[model samples]
Target: MKKLFQTSSLVSVLNVSDYTVALTWYSAWLSKPDETPMDGMAEWRIADNAWLQLDATAETVKPSAAIIGVNDLAACRTVLLEAGIAVGEIQDWEVVLSCDLHDLDGNKISLAQIISQQ
Candidate 1:
């Protein structure tokens, strides 16, 4: 069998009850305004090909979770703190450093920084 499709990008969605509030919070949290790809939807470009989408919904949307890799965990933590977002203490796992945080809708976002091989 041959590969039918190549994995080129990823788009993760986090549903929220309040679109305007979520948009403001996410814009501050990410330090960038979201792009409106359509009505009632906002998207943040996480990387070159990765995106995080926020959808406004009337129903109770389940909280979403994602693990994001960063180049500097400490720096990221500081930024989050300065932004008034609470983040867990950084834990060393021998191979990487990680911390956890949640959004307004209680969606979990884990951040990890890989240790470079010496």
Candidate 2:
């Protein structure tokens, strides 16, 4: 049998009342202001090629699964903080520094940077 492929793509959706506003913010956050928007959904492409989407019909909930790892933890944290999205404080794991946050819909979003071999 063929071995399973490495990690594929990811798509995460969050609900927001102001889809346009959310789109603008996400465009800046992802550094892709020209990114397209479809109907009630706006998407951001994370570093790992994960799709982070915002939908108008979604309801607030704890995320079942959502996270984005970055090369510069401190810088990423700063960006989120500057955008007023950082939740609580930065956490230090055995091999990473991470922050757990939520979007307008309350879906969990994590930003982390590796500190050592995992």
Candidate 3:
């Protein structure tokens, strides 16, 4: 049988206790304001089809994690640091380089730079 549907985009949600703080922090981290904003949520267009949504809630929520591929892990880390965001050490895993960063609510964002085979 033919497929009834096909996946197109991915939207990841991160729940936070404070919407304002999260929005500001994420905007700076992404270097762009949220493309969509609602009463208690904000969404950033990370790529052509990928989006990152921040949701505000009253209950304690566990931090969300997402892996974003970058062209230069070291440069990205430096930029984040200059922007005042704390970045973890970059790790070389034989096939890829990666680093982890946490948002204001402690949500983990893993940044990976794929090794290009020449």
Candidate 4:
């Protein structure tokens, strides 16, 4: 099949109801956003080619999910737990170790650490 659009960058957006609360919670979970392009929106540079964005809206939103690639899932989970966040049990999938959590708006966020089989 022929390509429809030229590639540039990828963005994953999690729409939320409360901007202020979501901003604070996400800051604790992912650190301060690298950029706040405009009001009611925040962005994090997940990788050279990808980004994660938080958008504030009053309309109904379906829960969205995102997986973050971390180098140490255990340490990441520990930090979040200490911050009083309800993080889920870590799952070991042979090639990956991961844990899950929800944002202020119930958006599912997963932290995954890839294990080298070498």
How close is each model in CA RMSD to the real structure?
2.1, 3.5, 2.2, 2.1
lDDT of 1 at 89: 98
lDDT per residue for candidate 2 within 1-105, as digits (tens), equals: 976888777777666777777666666567653345767776777646677777775665333447788888777778777876555577888788888776555
Residue 64 in candidate 2 has what lDDT?
Answer: 49
Q: What is candidate 1's CA lDDT for residue 105?
A: 87
* Residue pairs in collision within model 1: none
- Give the top-scoring candidate (lDDT): 4
Worst 10 residues of 3 by lDDT: 31-40
Instruction: Name the candidate that leads on TM-score.
Output: 3
lDDT of each residue in 25-80, candidate 3, tens digit only: 88887766556566778888888999888889547778889888889999999999
Tens-place lDDT digits, model 4, residues 12-36:
9999998899999888867999999
Which is better, 1 or 2, measured by lDDT? 1
Candidate 1 off by > 4 Å? 1-4
Point out the worst 10-residue segment of candidate 4 by lDDT.
Answer: 54-63
Point out the higher-scoring one by TM-score: 3 or 4: 3
lDDT of 2: 0.69
**Candidate 2: deviation at residue 104, Å?**
2.6
Which residue pairs in candidate 4 have backbone atoms (N, alpha carbon, C) closer than 3 angstroms, thus clashing? none
Clashes found in each candidate (C-alpha, N, C closer than 3 A): 0, 0, 0, 0
Residue-level lDDT of model 1, residues 1-118, one tens digit each, is: 9889899999888898788888878887785545887777888888899888888854778889988889999999999999888999999999999999887888888999999879
